[model samples]
Target: MVFLLLSLVLGVLVGILLPFHIPLVWGKYFSVALLAAIDSLLGAGKAVYEDRFDFWLFVSGFITNTFLAGLLTYAGDRLGVELYLAAIITFGVRIFQDLSILRVYLFKRFSTTGPQGVSKTRPETK
Candidate 1:
């Protein structure tokens, strides 16, 4: 988890420092692919919280979702239909749902009572 956080921060820093651009025609594909990647990351985080994180599953899901989203966007452009919107909505909803679950898990994990059955109003002392 720490590694993942560090990598994310590094990626953001690099993105900010780099000069790159995606062509306008490929904007839909980029957006959908990014959404898919985010959804996969959130899903992986939730799985980790649930103690069910699988390396293979995360790898396959990340690749498949990203590829399919980009493919859908490309196909939609070819067919003159807004199919990429479907990918966007699906991934967006999944991302939000994953975040909600993670939030609840974290709250439950950290908001419990302390010793002697007393509710913890602040950080526990050593």
Candidate 2:
């Protein structure tokens, strides 16, 4: 997970340093693919937090989700339908759900209780 996040940061930095541009004609495919990738990444994070992360599951899901999203976007374009919206909506909802799960896990992990059942927190500054 840390490696993946580092790679993402490096890729973003490279993209920013380079001046390459994707043509506007491929916007729908690009958007859907990006969203699918994010969805897969978040799913992996959620799996890791749940202590059930699997390499094969993450890889297969990442590839399949990205490819299916692009395929759907292409079909929608060819058929004159805005089918990409479905993928976008699905991915968006999933991303939020994953984030929520992660957030809850973080809160529980960090907010441990004392022997008296008092929640642990930072001491107040004088």
Would you list the C-alpha lDDT of every candidate in the order shown? 0.86, 0.86
- Off-target runs (Cα >4 Å) in candidate 2 are 1-6, 114-126
Model 2 clashing residue pairs (backbone): none
- Tell me how candidate 1 scores on lDDT: 0.86
Give residue 106's error in model 1 in angstroms: 0.8
Give candidate 2's error at residue 102 in angstroms: 0.9
Query: TM-scores of the models, in the given order?
Result: 0.82, 0.81
| CA RMSD, predictions in order | 5.4, 7.0
Tens digit of per-residue lDDT, candidate 1, span 2-113: 8989999999999888899788988878889999999999999898877778999999999999999999988988999989999999998999999998877666667665
Candidate 1 ranges beyond 4 A from true positions? 1-3, 114-126
Candidate 1 displacement at residue 78 in angstroms: 0.6
Candidate 1 matches the true fold with a TM-score of 0.82
* RMSD after Cα superposition, model 1: 5.4
